[model samples]
Target: MTTSFETLYQNLQAAVDDELQTLLCHHQPRLLWESMAYSVLGGGKRLRPLLCLLACEAVSGKWQPALPAAQAVELIHAYSLIHDDLPALDNDDWRRGKPANHKEYGEDIAILAGDALQTLAFQLLSDPAIRRPDVQVRWVAELAGAAGPMGMCAGQVLDLHAADSVWKEAEILDVYRRKTGALIRAAVRMGALAGGAGPEQLQALTGYAEDLGLAFQIVDDLLDLTGSFEALGKTPGKDLMQDKKTYPALLGQAEARQKVESCLLRARDVLFSVPLLQTGHLLQIAEKLVHRET
Candidate 1:
């Protein structure tokens, strides 16, 4: 039988897919448009954008107004992935079952593409048609915090340093939270702020995002162990090869799964304090994330 989480995930996925298509079609550049489109439109779970939309809905804001922000979050995510696949980083040869951006387009173009996408995210946030200047500034700051030295970038540095070293579970969580969870949390906060959430509401959603983000990383770790390339759409077992710390490495597989479940439950509990009707989709997403195969 299909679970409620699966049903909600499909609905959110459809919405995110449509939004991404519309945004990509509308935005064009003089050069490397094709590469930019390929990077942005590549197949992956639209988790960041979905979080934006859900956070908007959770705070009684019109979700439509946050679509641009959602697109911006996704652009940032795409940029990170593009850079992550570079030879200097993960050295990945494939992504989503296709040649890596650097491999397909050449490293120079791939780097430029990522740079352009990162800038484009700010442009999207600043578009006068989409958001007020104040909101734009706030959202841009949030994005910068999540993507720059103090956030995802820092996490990546930690990840590189930890390679071939034994790391405690806390250290692993610290790295994942910064590298992965920071942007995820930013996505949620940006959506909530755009949706007119007050400080209190934002606080609750922040907690929810934290739990959800950690659970996401844990699930990713689990998939690396249990999934195949066909199902994962990327190389599995790469973490093990790299000797990177992961939830499953620190905690046993069974314990890691339990941790994910616990995190999802905590996320749900936090969301439950809000009006159930307002947070239904967000709650559904937290549950669905834990159980996703890819």
Candidate 2:
């Protein structure tokens, strides 16, 4: 029997592929479209969209209604990765076993592609297909807050600054909360709201998402220490070389693993308290995140 996470992952990938292909079908400058497709279609786990779909289902909302929003989340995620891999940023040469966007495409095209994807996210959200105008507006606002200077961008800035300084664990946690946790938390909350969750349920699910996000980052840090480039689909040990603070760097490998476990436990506990049936899939996602090889 297929596990719930496996099934959900397949479904999420299908949805993402469909949405992305539709976006790519439009006639545009070939170079721009190809660059956009390269960054977006480069294999990814599609975790953000999965969270959106599951969160919607958890609230008894139809998953179809949340598809646009899910696609929006994914676009935003792809845009972030494209920018993150830029020479000015992480300077990564590989993503999902392929050359990073800027490495394959010119740096200018890659930057433009990232910008286009970011704008497309909002365009997707604003489409009439997504029901509830108020919900869509709120979702856009939330996503903006998470992706902008006050959130992930700010976290990246802090990371760059911390490259030359000794950062405490708390400071590192703050950076991850913004860089990684913000989008993740937004994905969950947006899913819940799209599914028409009550305020209380949303609150509980947010807690679950937040814990899971932290655990995900902790595991990512651990993987960087031990995983091979082939298994990781990106450069490992980059964080250490960059002098960026990570959970493993601050807490030691064993302690970092323990922290991931603790966070996953807390996420599961939060799920248990919620009445949403989709919590089963959320728990599975949390497990997969910690155990993922790539």
Candidate 3:
């Protein structure tokens, strides 16, 4: 029987979680590990890691070989969230329905935890167990590029600047591309590369990832406005409170939802255009992201 998307997601999430738990258990210094694990093991969608695994499977690569990369992306994602919630950034008091790392563990510990997780991601990528050195090298570069100055960090910088001024549509989109979409695109590409996908297939996945990323941000904007604290696991209406530039701020709620639908359709088109072995899970993921209540 074909595995359902929910089943596949649950299995992959468990696998990634186990890997993180094992890694943390072996690390020295109990408090540091505890802080890192607190943010990592906390409730999350695990979307980046899941996308990595699914992309690997879609490219006919054994997903097991890509597990390290998947884990690495999640680590980077978790670290980003930790830092993003700091007072210097978004100043969020809660995440995933729990106290923010900074609030729960104090600002200093939270900063260190984020830094440690970021470095650990690179460590995971460098592990010799992940198959070919060439693939490993590519994975390292892909992930670093996505998470560093050229991608997510740059987006954060843009976000900081935007707080002081009104942003154009293009500028907001650029922030979305780098801040949210870059790592997601890298997750898909890294998985495909690990699976030995060709240039054409990689390009298709890139397009699909980019659209999905935009849809994700748009949905996020919608949720911040329309969702509740119970559903989002974080404070609602934060965007408006912070005066952050968002799709809903620029396009309005109905228009933002419409935009998400459009982006999802385009993403689906790109995903189906490629000759993937199994794309149902990816399609479902895209749909869930676009229409998610939280």
Q: Model 1 over residues 1-294: C-alpha lDDT tens digits?
A: 247657766777787778767766644553465677788888888889889988987786467767788889999999999999998988889899999888888898899989988998998898888637877898999999999999999999999878767788999999989999999999999999888888778888999999989999999999999999999888999999888888898889999989898988888888876652377778777766778998
What's the C-alpha lDDT at position 267 in model 1? 88
Cα TM-score of candidate 2: 0.96
Better of 1 and 2 by TM-score: 2
lDDT of 2 by residue, 1-294 (tens): 147558767977898788888887646688998989887876888888888888888887467767787888888999999999998989899998889999998899999999999999999898877558999998999899989998899988998788678888899999989999999999988988888898889999999989988988888888888989989989999988888889898879999888889998998898878677566777787888877866
- Write down the TM-score of every candidate: 0.93, 0.96, 0.96
Each candidate: what lDDT?
0.85, 0.86, 0.89
Ranking of models by TM-score: 3, 2, 1
Candidate 1 residue spans exceeding 4 A from truth: 1-15, 25-31, 275-277
- The pairs that clash in candidate 3 are none
- Which candidate wins on lDDT? 3
Q: Which scores higher on lDDT, 1 or 2?
A: 2
